[model samples]
Target chain A: MISNPLFFVFIVVLIIWIGIALLLFRIDRKISLVEKEVSEALDEK
Target chain B: MFLYRLVYVLMPIGIFLSLLWVPPANILGDASRILYFHVPVAWVSFLAFLVAGLHSIALLIKKSEILYREAMAYNSAAIGMVFTVLTVITGSIWAKVSWGHFWNWDPRETSIVILMLIYIAYFSLFSALKSNPNRWGISSVYLIISMIIAPFLIFIVPRVYPSLHPDTIINQDKKIHLEASMRITLFFLVVTFTLLYGYIYKITNKLSLIIIKLRSSHDI
Candidate 1:
């Protein structure tokens, strides 16, 4: 009963979604950091 | 900012609906839940590719400045490639559950594989042309050609060749095969995925713009 492949499939999908969400969040954060740095550089100029 | 927060709320609801709220299909059972993710991701991939293709056309026509349009096309293609890969992954899992195999060279499967290869080739060409003086012109032409072929690969080939894939929402009879609850849930998920794609596209484009700005300022 505990070995149902359906359960595994659901888990796999959930994991994929979580991974994608994390990747997007990371990209957004990194881009924000870069933008801040660029604006600061422009301001200094 | 409000839109970003909206995604936070809506995506969770979409997840909840797909994983818990929607009833199982009569035959595929719980495996049917993957449809919510697979279909939306595939749709977004197509949308992203379309955006890329349109930008390519505009780039060729305007010829004013290549950077912005080229960047937009690049970003859109990148997103399209990512989403297409996701579609394949989710579709494969669904297939494993239903077809007892991950792949069997079904027409629908073959078409998607061909689509993936096309985009992969595009990326390879893009990188290979990095130092070429006419990179923008060459890549734009390539993207335009890809855009022309995309529809045939996605829609026509799948229908013309017999497929093991299930009937689409609008089949030959021009009727929806989904139940009301399923249809609504699918629609909600699609909208959520589209919004998610839009959000990603906006940020990525902004990043490109900022980089261009920085580069121009540096040149000055």
Candidate 2:
């Protein structure tokens, strides 16, 4: 296991996967705001 | 969103299984296990580019309704390029361990880099024609051209040319001789990575929509 090259790849992929998930929530919030405004505008029209 | 959540929950489990349970190939020893990670990311890059190319075609299909679609295509391409870069980086890591060097511009390496360059050129063209109303049509055509040549550039050229990269998984007669264990792990990884790609693609689309809305509202 210690000698497996794939073990390292697993570590790196996990890090990147977590990083993307962290950013997703922050970006998701911002986009939700825009979507809300667009819906509101349509309702007003 | 639910799929992505499920993928996240499952992917780590798959990684654990691969890392701890799977045995290495007799020829490749333990290093061959990197295929579990490397192949999936490369597959995602191909899928992302194809999706972008499809969006580009949609640009040509509709005359005045091209705005959001073009932005979607551009964002998808941007994400695809990111994945391709990751593919190269991770592959380089594997190369250093397996081949005793990081890079030698092997046939496979060169072909992937050429695809990257084409995408870079696409962005440059986009910037040059940003203000033109017909930019969408022109850019879409460019993407379509790349899409047409993509299979040849990525798969055929590397195999046809002599290289250090492994031969095609499918032989000339269309038979794959993948080991049963490795094949199963590959399938799992490919499905996991493809789901991850879908999540990112949707996120990119949402972000692009927000950016366009912000621009029209002068919120930026």
What TM-score would chain A of each candidate receive against the reference chain A?
0.78, 0.55
Question: DockQ, per-model, please?
Answer: 0.42, 0.41
Candidate 1 global TM-score: 0.89
Q: Return the lDDT, model 2, position B21.
A: 64
Candidate 1 local lDDT, B1-220, one digit each (tens):
4576467567767876777778899999887988998999999999999999999999999996699899999999999999999998989999999999999788878888998899999999999999997889999998899898988998888888888899987579999999998998899989988888888988889899898988899799
lDDT tens string, model 1, A1-45? 238555565576667777878888888888888889898989899
Report the C-alpha lDDT of model 2 over A1-45, residue by residue, as the tens digit.
657566677788678767876787577677777778886875665
TM-score leader: 1
Q: What digit string (tens of lDDT, one per residue) describes model 2 on residues B1-220?
A: 7786567676776686567667777777777767778888888888788888998987788754577899888887888898899899888988887788999889889989999999999999999998997899999999888888778888888878888876567657686667777788888888988887787777778777766765666642
Look at candidate 1 and give me any clashing residue pairs. Answer: none
Name the regions of candidate 2 deviating beyond 4 angstroms: A1-16, B214-220
